[model samples]
Target: MTVSVRALRPGNRSDAEAFARIRMLALPYVFFTADSVEHLTARLHPDAHFTALLAEDDGEAIGTAQLSLAHESPEPGQALLNVHVRPDRTGRGAGTALVQAGEELLAGLGAHKVFSWVLDEPADRVFAERRGYRPGSTAQFLLLDLAKAELPPVPAPPPGVELRTAADFADDPRPLFELDAECTADEPGDVDHRLGDYGAWLEETWRHPLLRHDLTTVAVADGRPVAFTAVRTDGGVRYGTGMTGTARAHRGRGLAKLVKADSLHRARAAGFTEAHTGNDAGNEPMLAVNRWLGYRVCAREVQHVRELG
Candidate 1:
């Protein structure tokens, strides 16, 4: 039996389903759906040179990789290739084949540096190290049982500040985009990204399959969005916080906590039973907020970086 790596056929239902299945099996802490997979494939920026690769054995997809350049970053030549192989199919060399193919593709596209996320496990770390990747930063995935965990009561916004849903800005989302850009620049990550493309953000984030605008809570100050908690739901029992951030001037005001609490309360009211979120290990403020919300650390993934000259 031989394993071969090839690009994913986004239009193929079987391929999309197989890719989603393998990803869920490899990393069950996050959310991945067929619609979301297709959405990503269809909406990637042309300049990013995005490609989704699949490793197949005997015509069965056993691994998947999402490869793309960070087109929106201020720095050039930054790329990401996140690969995941089915748990039961690891020893078949699917992971190695997938990473090799993904790296070669990104390198061909002129990527100077490449990054990937490896689960915080011995085998996973060893595989990355063997490939010349070095550990950079670590992130923790937190989980909360919305159905059983006791969530904090929603707090009232300070005077002149009001809580609003992302849905309220449907007519014009540019303010949210601006706020997103400000907050994203300060997010703790190995790669620094700049949300300079409002149009791209609209197509990629605002209209994403999983993003639930009604459940997303935002804090508005004098009609401007200062802080927000982005929500994503599977339309089932699982919900995730895509992002939670406050403007530079709004920090230390407890607005982040207020928005997050409002978002969680809305998520529970919408029938979501489980809540999932991730934060950089060093982001103590956000980590404290999650802990205060009753979230517990469930898993950790380390960022690995490899330089290609």
Candidate 2:
């Protein structure tokens, strides 16, 4: 069967849903929905040059590829192209077509490098290797069964620190933004990101559709956020921590664990049955924290990098 790739139409419900379905089938650990797809595509910074490509086979959507310039990276001409094909549709030409289309788009944008995250499976690694992508860092996806696992009790905050929900700063979330920026700069990753764009942060992270501010927990010190566990809910029974980190000065005091525990307890009490999070394979600290929280590693993915011609 012949496969062709085309740009996904924003605001088209069918397109969004089909993209979401493909993503869920290929990478169940990550969170995605039609609403999130639409929101992200519509709210991307103008400089991002982002596009969602769908691979169709005989009038049926069977794969997806998200291609974009790393507009927030300090390095110029860096691009990202993550392709995922439906499990049932593997071995078809869809994956190859999607990759070809994505590369063309990135090359047209003058990208000097392209990165992709592929599941750490034999076939997936082979597919990337055959196309000149070299394996980079690996990350683990974790799952915690809120209904069955035994979660550690929320710990008491240190004397000077106070626990609060992200909702507490509804009037002004600049403190949280500052903390997020600090943490993001220090996160273990292959790319160096420049998150100094406050306006873009407000649009991309603060106002995102899946961000559950009410369930997100923050640790405050001296009236400023020192640590936080950002939450994303599917409006169902699943909740995921989008990012959990502590300010560098406040590290080693276990504030991240405290806020994450609080968030998990609150989420379960509010009827969330499953919780998910991801950690870089090199990040032993966060991995330990997740283990202490009863999260078990469910899957692993490897990043592949290629220098564009």
Candidate 3:
């Protein structure tokens, strides 16, 4: 069977659905859908140079790749590529073909390094090592069975602070965006981030199809958002925490925990039976909050880096 890779068709519902299906089949823990796929392709910053590629065997898609330059990072020449093949279709060359195509795109963009997430599985690790990729920091994908797990009571905000949903800022979300930028800059990750572009944030995040604004809890202190936990729904029973963070000044106040708990409660009440989130291994504070909320690590994936010569 001839394996070929090509860019996902813009504005095509079929291609978007196929891409999302292959991705979800390969990695079900992350939140994604046809709408989410289209959103990524349409809303990404132009500087990001993002491209979604589909891998096919004789014209039938079997894998997907999302590759882009780390445009928002302080560092330069760094690119990201994540390739996932359908679990049932793995013995073929589709994965390798997709990876080669993705790397070619990144390298052509003048990227010096390519970082990819490799699942914590024997076959997955060997696949990367054979391709010259070296494993780096690991991340844990946690899952909470909201229907059966006991969720903690939402913490009461301290005096002068109150908890509200993202919907509360319906007319204006800049405060939430500001808080998100501040917390994102300090987030634990391999690539340092810069969220200085409000326009990009509004398109890529605020209008994202999966973001459940009404279920996303925000901590307001004196009329400003100091902490927040954003929620993403699968249009069904699953909900995922997109990000949870507190303003640097508000650290150690359990605001992260407070916001996350409230978001979870709202998600459960809204009929989402399963919840998912991921944390960098070194992020102890957020991990602790997840544990307190009864989320258990369901899978682990390591970031693998390969330098382009």
Candidate 4:
């Protein structure tokens, strides 16, 4: 059986569906949708050189890869080649083929380094190592059985603070954008992402299909957004926090916990039976917060990096 890999056909409904399906099957912990996949590939910045690659075994897509440069990073030549093969189709050559196409594209784009996320499982680790990639930081995929987990009671916002949803900022989201920019800048990760392009953020994140603005909670102080727990839903019973953080000025006021708890409670009330979120293993503060929310670790993934001359 010969496996052929090529760039995804943008605006093709079948391509988007196949890519999203393979992603959901291979990485069940995360949420994805065909619309989101199409939106990302269509709206990506030109400098990123983003390509959604598909590996086909006998004309059927069995592996998917998202190749692109980390354009927002201050570092030069930083690229990503994240490959995920359908679990049942792993033994075939599709994974390798997809990876080769990704690396070739990145190298052609003058990338000096490439990063990927591999499942912490032995086979995934081995596959990455065999490709000359070295393991770096680890992150956990956590799940909370909202129907059974004992959630802490939502607390009232402190004096001069109010609880609101991301929907409240539809008129003008620059405040939320500023808060996201600050918090994301301080995140602990192998790659540094600075959300400097507000217009890009609006197109790529704010208007994203999976973003549940109605359920995303924000804490405002003195009529300004301060902390937030951005939420995403799979249009099913599953819900996940896309990003949760507090502004630098509001760190110790328990706003992070407050917004997260409020969001989870609302998620459950709205019939979302399962809640999911991820955190870097080194983020002790967030780990503590999730523990308080009754989230248990379900899976772990490690970052793999390879340097190129």
The C-alpha RMSD of each candidate to the native structure, in angstroms, is 0.9, 0.8, 0.8, 0.8
Model 3 RMSD vs true structure? 0.8
Q: Where does the lowest 10-residue lDDT sum fall in candidate 4?
A: 2-11
Candidate 1, residue 48: Cα displacement in angstroms equals: 1.3
lDDT of each: 0.91, 0.92, 0.93, 0.93
Q: Model 2, stretches more than 4 Å misplaced? A: none
Clashes of each: 0, 0, 0, 0
Q: Model 2, range 136-218, lDDT digits (tens) per residue?
A: 99999999999887888999899899999989988998889899999998989887777888888888899999999899999
TM per candidate comes to: 0.98, 0.99, 0.98, 0.98
- Rank by lDDT, descending? 4, 3, 2, 1
By summed lDDT, which 10 consecutive residues of candidate 2 come out lowest?
191-200
Flag clash pairs in model 2: none
**Across residues 1-309, which tens digit of lDDT does each residue of candidate 4 receive?**
889998888689999999999999999888888988998898878889989999999998999999899989999899998999999998998888888889988999999899999999999999999999999999999999999988999877888999999999999999999999999999999999999988998988899999999999999988999999999999889999978999998898889899999999999999999999999999999999999999999999999999976
lDDT of 2: 0.92
lDDT of 1 by residue, 66-175 (tens): 99998878889999989999999889999999888988898899998999999999999999999999999999999999999889998888888999999999999999
Backbone clash total, candidate 4: 0
- RMSD in angstroms between candidate 4 and the native structure over all alpha carbons: 0.8
